[model samples]
Target chain A: MSEPRFSVGQRVQIADRTPPVHHRVPSYAKGHVGVVERVCGMHANPELCIRGDGKPFQRIYRVRIPQTDLWAPYEGTDGDKLEIEIFEHWLELAQ
Target chain B: MTGHDDHDHGRTFQPDHPEPTSDAALVGLALRELLIEGGHYTAEEELAVIAEMQGASPENGGKIVARAWTDPEYKKRLLINGKDSIKELGFDLEPYEFTVMENTDQVHNVIVCTLCSCYPRALLGMSPAWYKSRNYRSRVVREPRAVLSEFGVDLSDDVDVRVHDSTAELRYMVLPQRPAGTDNWSEDDLAALITRDSLIGTQRDLSTK
Candidate 1:
């Protein structure tokens, strides 16, 4: 019964660490900073649930990250953004 | 009407990648027959489900979008609770919750499933092959504006582009801005302009027609 770590509009960073197997967290988002757009509710972690192992539901958030921050050579417009759903455990409060 | 003796087997043989050549089809047929014989699920039920899925298409989503365009209250309800609002149209949205992202004059929205190809199948039917391609999955987030331009949706630098990745159970659809010069157009006329790609946020100018 842990409380949600991040709030809407709060800045956070996805953990850069790689897991042993496939995960929902995309590689492009790792180590990138974003702001929580919406609290999308708790859901079973696919990494564990897909393996048929019973796991606790984790808080999911819709995080909005600037496209420029994600790709170093990104030449898109400045206002472009990329939003991804991230699990609470995979995110940490951005410095 | 050609005889088997006259058929050239060598010509049909593929080298690098061989086709299944009915072997896989036979196995699938056998498995399906076994399942039906075991009463696991009736063949009728399977056909009914297939028919139900076939009945679903972008038209369903188009109807919703058309209604939202003319009715402000329904639009508000759709934005607040997408699943329930869609259910109001007598459609069942199961397994995944649905969300509608609004495309205003200043901001536009696009959807992608970076993990796997998750989408609003109940409303919009199957996603296009391009939506599931690795090229799209890898580039859209990194270069949204560029990717959109390839789809013929060019936006000004001032307008913001938002990309929503379907990482969870929730599914998203875009509510594109209503086209102009069709103020008094019927619901059917308005719905006709909403294309499958338009619902995905790839094309913005629906007024072209």
Candidate 2:
């Protein structure tokens, strides 16, 4: 079993690559930075699972991105947040 | 009714749209018949599973929330292990991760799945059409407070609003605080007040005094 790449509260950024097939990462979340809120359990890449690709699994993390960071015209207060479940393969440690 | 049918003549009624069948539905129908023909399972057994699905309504979630409200230990267990805690109540939330996000006086929480319509169908049955709408999927994550206000949930500015986007495999449900006036209410009574929207965090006011 592979160890989780990121921990809760760690800063990470979503990878910007565009896969040709189905993937869990949303277009809106691509290339964005967020804080890991929870290390949700590991699971096979849903894109592969749907295709019966028989690929190994990776850890899924719940990352909390601030609304203001996601949208420049965000109207809510500063503390507002949007949390998304992202797989470990799509994330990298932020500087 | 027979006289009315005679007046309508031998012509059968034809609606504008033919029941709006989709490719997915047709595929599902074919798969079911194929499975039955192969002797994998009888149609009667399939109906039993259908019956089980019919029982997967928000009422089960209400029972969990109500129990959590009355039992502190149960609430802790739910926060830590939502799947196991729900199973303790004889509810099945299998093949998915069930996470309970608690709403406290300091903060408010709402759930949305921005990527496709992933939800806790085993616990809440089919998600409302609005929950699956593209407009909602896009707007809620960007403007949760504004969207929530449209649902008649206007939290004060001081309270932080957190919108959870269930983008991947896990599913989320809100664990709203027990309303103030319901301190003396029984578990069953409290469960009655729990709305599907509240379980999803679109609404929080559950006081029934």
Candidate 3:
């Protein structure tokens, strides 16, 4: 990844789309909103690498999402949350 | 068993004649042979690596956690860059970004791989059998608190449970809070308290008893 487009503490949403291909963004995190918890540096775009193409590297971020938002009536504590690594392409600025 | 026998030329693995188990074994066999044929490595070298990995006990992680307990400065670096910090202790976690999640009075952290069974093998050795099961990968992210209870880590409703789902390029390790009664304990003694499951956040509260 040339430059990181997202910053820590900024709100963002994981791309909700599901393509029937090998990808890094897990299905559960799709379409959910989370905050960028860490800029995990650049990595080879996994989607491209799956097709044996690795030219483009993409920035990765660790997004922190409240468990309640991810699962309604989440049984854990109010502060319970999940942090997952999402690539730059799978995320968008959320309101 | 048959592993050493097969590698020692007991059975010819032709890609065209693939059996059920042979299909998966094909990938590893091919790579191993290629490395040997290319002179990039030898079977002895390969076996040595396998031996080293097999010998790499979870104590590797215990040593790191124990050192972090005694050295605040090392702990800070470990939280920031877990890969490098562990390497400072002669352990290597290459190619992947290793992030250490700390557990405290207010928050408890757990590690998982929802997409597949990814783990920080180079640091913590092989993942536990339960970690690779579909049940864990699927359930832990959705109901972490309940799963922690099943692991015998019943928490007080006040503590926040944070789950870290790793990707192919990244790995996470948990830095559990040090037990209170062992301030004067030696690093080796403290390390004995850090269990493999504790390093993964499935277990907490290292007991000096």
Q: Candidate 2, which segments miss by more than 4 Å at Cα?
A: B1-25, B35-42
Cα lDDT tens digits for candidate 2, B1-209: 23333432112222232442788866766776677658797666766676677668898889999999999999999998787888999886676788999999978999998878888877887799999999998889878888999999998878889998888778889998888777899999999989999989999888685
Over B1-209, each residue of candidate 3 has an lDDT whose tens digit, in order, gives: 22554364213433344453666686777776677668796666666777677777778888999999999999999999887888889987777888999999999999999888888776788888999999999899989988999999999988889999996588888999999989899999999998889989999878889
What's the i-RMS for candidate 2 in angstroms? 0.9
Please write out the lDDT profile of model 1 over residues B143-187, one tens digit for every residue: 788899999998897789999988877899999999878889999
For A18-59, candidate 3 gives per-residue lDDT tens digits of 777778888788999999999987878777776776547888
Clashing residue pairs in candidate 2 are none
- Between prediction 1 and prediction 2, the one with superior DockQ is 2
- Cα lDDT for residue A80, candidate 1: 80
Best-fitting candidate, scored by DockQ? 3
Could you give candidate 1's fraction of true interface contacts? 0.82
Query: Candidate 1: TM-score?
Result: 0.83
Error of 3 at A36 (Å): 0.4
CAPRI docking class of candidate 1:
medium
In every candidate, what fraction of the native interface contacts is reproduced? 0.82, 0.90, 0.84
Off by over 4 Å in 1: A1-3, B1-43
Best by lDDT: 3
